[model samples]
Target: MMFNKLFSFFTVFLIGSSICFAQNANRLDSLVTVLENNKLPKNEKIQLLIKIAHNHTNTDEGMHYAKQSLQMAIEINDLVLQSQAWEEIGTIEQRLGNKNNALDAIFKALHIYDSLNLKDKQAASYMQIGGHHVGEKEYDPAIIYFQKAEKIYSEIEDDLYLAFVLTNLGEAYRFEGQLENATTSLTKALELNKSLKNDVVEGYALGNLGMVYAAESKFTKAKTFLTKAIAITNRLQGAYPTCVYIAALGSVYEKEGDFLLSESKYTEAFAMAKSAGLKEQIRDFSAVLTGFYEKHSDYKKALKFQKVYQQYQDSLVNRENIQKNEQLKADYEVSKRESEISILNITNANQKRWGIALISGFVILLFLAYLLYRGNREIKKSNQVLSDQKELISKREQEKALLLQELNHRVKNNLQMVSSLLNLQSRELTGHPAREAILSGKYRVEALSLVHRKLYQEGVDTKIPLKDYIQELVLGLFEGYNAEFEPNFSIADINIGIDVAIPLALIINEMVINSLKYAYDGIENPLLKIVIMQETKEDLHLQVIDNGIGFTKNDNEKNNSFGLKLITSLIEQLEGTMERINTKGTHWEMKIKLS
Candidate 1:
């Protein structure tokens, strides 16, 4: 009776597997027919190729089709299509048990998707990476990536993809022994899929939930959920999830002391996995059967199943070795092709250079002949014309200089009038908050006016003498603030263009104002020193030191004020860096790079 029952079960299983295979074959045939049209657009062809690859995911044909899609995508320079192809290739590699290669391909896809800012595609790649990590029994990283995918899917409001991520996340959590989290994630995924009417992912979530319950020793719940999961997975999904659900059901039965039913379910799942050519599942089930028989002291059956388990394990290792060898051969062929292309390019470049050289030599000879054909009178006339042009250019340059100086003088006068107006406004607003702000504006305007004043007074319009400019600016600040200390200057005899001079002057003005207003409070004697030295041909070092109280809390708060922000902007404009040291007093040092 038992033999007949087992035979009947095998027959039904084989028929169902055959039906699934036929459906896949029909799908592949239809896709290939669509792909055969040579007049199809490259983009459409790449899409079809990817679809075909997905259909053949269980075999090498999938990799072949994926690579074809990648090549076509590259030819058309379509980044999105290329990323999709790479993602398909990664899925195929993972199915083929090349975990490392799968990870590498998926990461390549993720990088491209990230660059293109495709959130959906990035989440998909993250899920793929998490699945690979789960396969390797590395649950921590698996959960991390699954959570990352979850976050993105939620942000995009993609409940369908979110359900898929949650299903995987729950499974990873179950494997890592976090049963509560596993149940929570799987339950949410189940509800999401049901709401979305996605029966496929719903089946996955149900199966994972069953596995989690089993791990928690809830035998009744585990069996109930596993049975329902098997019904849905077997009818809607395929051999993979159905086989896993069946194995979990068998384990639940064993825990409940139903030895006969447990053995039957294990044997059934193993046979189905073996018939489907799922080597990983086959090896796993065989090991389970081996342990089951040993628990019952059935040595003969235990030995038989143990040998089957070892056989498949060896087969997996040999397959990996063969894959490695094939990869090495492929790499060598690619390298050889690249070297041949490089040599051809060099030969073409040398030929082109020789052709250019011949043409240039002939042209040069013709030019010499032309020069000889000309008379001395023509040469004298050309020389006279050149001299006349030079004289005219020099006069124009002198005129431009005079005009620039006049413009600078007028700009200085205008800025002084603005400063005077600000002073007048401050007097009227005495005892008001606006008065202080107006005075600060006056000082900044004077700093800029000083730059223009130096440009108009100096012999050179573009360059300013740094030593003289700093001295006058600092002295003017002291007189404006009515400070009691005299500032010492140790400046380098350097010349700078107006671009650097204007910003530098404002920076000095702000720093001096900060020192006078904040640094010298509650001090008996105050000293301020300004130093500028040439660090290199294209670098300058500047120091502003004050012998008073160090940088206080008030100064820190002032750093966020408009004055400090303006100083920061000017420093950035000059491509310079500043460092503040509060030892002894407050020391501000800067390194400015000349552009």
Candidate 2:
């Protein structure tokens, strides 16, 4: 009972039976006794209350006791009692025709189910609330509630409850004029009830199925399903009373134009109502009789039954006003709670703002401090990087200067030693070839000396231009030979870096010596030419020409000439390629790539 009061209510409701008034009152009274004194255990008492609210009396006195029990259950804060109470409230509201209050109570129960994470409770409450709305003739809301409940019931493996809810949903849909949807829902409920051996749910489904067929104007289907429903009701032996079953069948017979059969059914329904003492169904019997007499075109009898039906309908509507007020009271209690929550929220928001502001200020200060520290470190690191880069540039420059100096010194000294050796060899010989070798070595020394001379004269730290150095190298070689040469026979204007000058001068010495000594060996006229130019930004082109007998095949005959070997080695070291084209004389071409 307490559980019902605490959490139940979210949907519309009722588990109705065509029970006699006396039996219904007795059942409600017994529920009150068990729930009032807490005679049963917590769960048991809650279940009892749910049963009473679902299948109890249809009287106002029954509702009053249920509400009291529900309130008491709420005070105890028991979840089961809470759910039961909300369900009872919705049911009572539905009976009283106060649909909104019924809806409100069920929603409260749904909120509780959400808190408790009880899927079954949620589903059951939805179905109950849906049923309540249906009673108020609010079929749309009723279908929504029942469908939600059916879905939840399916989730928890409660086939019986799921079928029950679906059957209710089908009824709602039927009343809303959706015969197809109604038929589908009822059929599904029928299958589920059959599986669970729930003949009551099955019978409800069958009756609803017939109602849908009737609404759709499918008389054949309507008759078949109603006949089945009648059989189910008979087997249940008045457990759900006989009046509704007889009335449903009578209505079908009238639709089929079977006056005698229809009359028989209506009489039987009236008899059952009298025996059961169910005031509502007894009143519904008058409407059934009216439909029968109208089918037979008995205007007087039809009008009488119609009047009786009208009276019954009026009383039902009048009874609902009481239900409406009771629901408003329930809603008032819920509104009170919502107001308390809103007030608490406002107070909490005000309190939280200061804490949030303090935390935000602290965070901002921490971030700013971090940024400042990082900036200072970054500045210091940038300064260090600049200092290191400058030092590296300076060191490389100094090392380059020293390297050029050492290389220049070694070249000058090595050439002089070779010159001295050549001189000694020349002195030992009596021929001109020995003197030519001596002169050639001396010319190479002169070419290297020019680089040192420029470094000293120009006062630059490391490098010297090769133009002046090459001119000096050629002049020295000519002077040694004491041979005349025109400007056209010279490459004196060639330019190169000091790095390229020494090797180029050495190569030139060999070429010039070989030509002068051999090309003019027997001839009187001799010619030589050299030219230097750049083929690309990173490449240099060199050419040498001689007007004399061309190179012999013996020149390349391997493993012999020291001059040729030295020339080839220097070409490799410079990463330059050389090719020869012979005509009247040798034409040598080279293209060198510079780093």
Considering every candidate listed, which one attains the maximal lDDT? 1
Q: Write the per-residue lDDT of candidate 2 for residues 1-595, one digit (tens) a residue.
A: 1111111112233332221112335655776676778456655655565565555544355466567657767777786667667767766665444456666777777677766777777777667656666655667777777777777777777776777778787777777778788788888887776668766776678877876776666778877887887777566543233456556666667767787887887788777665544445556677667656655656567667766666555555432454454666576567648867999999999987776576676878768866886998999999999999999998788556555555555555444445544544554554776665665566665666666656644543555655565556666666667767642333434345666766776777777767766665554576778787766767778887888777677765843688878887877777899888868877888877654
- TM-scores for all candidates: the values are 0.49, 0.45
lDDT: worst 10-residue window of model 2 = 1-10
Model 2 spans > 4 angstroms off: 1-43, 49-75, 92-108, 114-117, 216-221, 234-242, 270-285, 294-300, 318-595
lDDT of 1 at 154: 97
C-alpha lDDT (0 to 100) for residue 595 of candidate 2: 46
For 1-595, candidate 1 gives per-residue lDDT tens digits of: 1111111010001000111211346677988999989999999999888777766525577689989989999999998888888887877666555556776677677777766788878788888878877876778998999999899989989897788889888888877778899899989988887778766566777777777777778878888888887887676535666776897788888888999999999999998777656667777888788778867866567667877876676565433443454464465446546757999999999997786676676878757656765766698899999999999998688667767776787688678767856765676687998888999999999989999989987943699999999999999989988997799999999889898888898999989998898788888889999999998989889999998788667667767889889988988888999999758888999988766
For all candidates in order, the CA lDDT equals 0.77, 0.64
lDDT of 1 at 232: 78
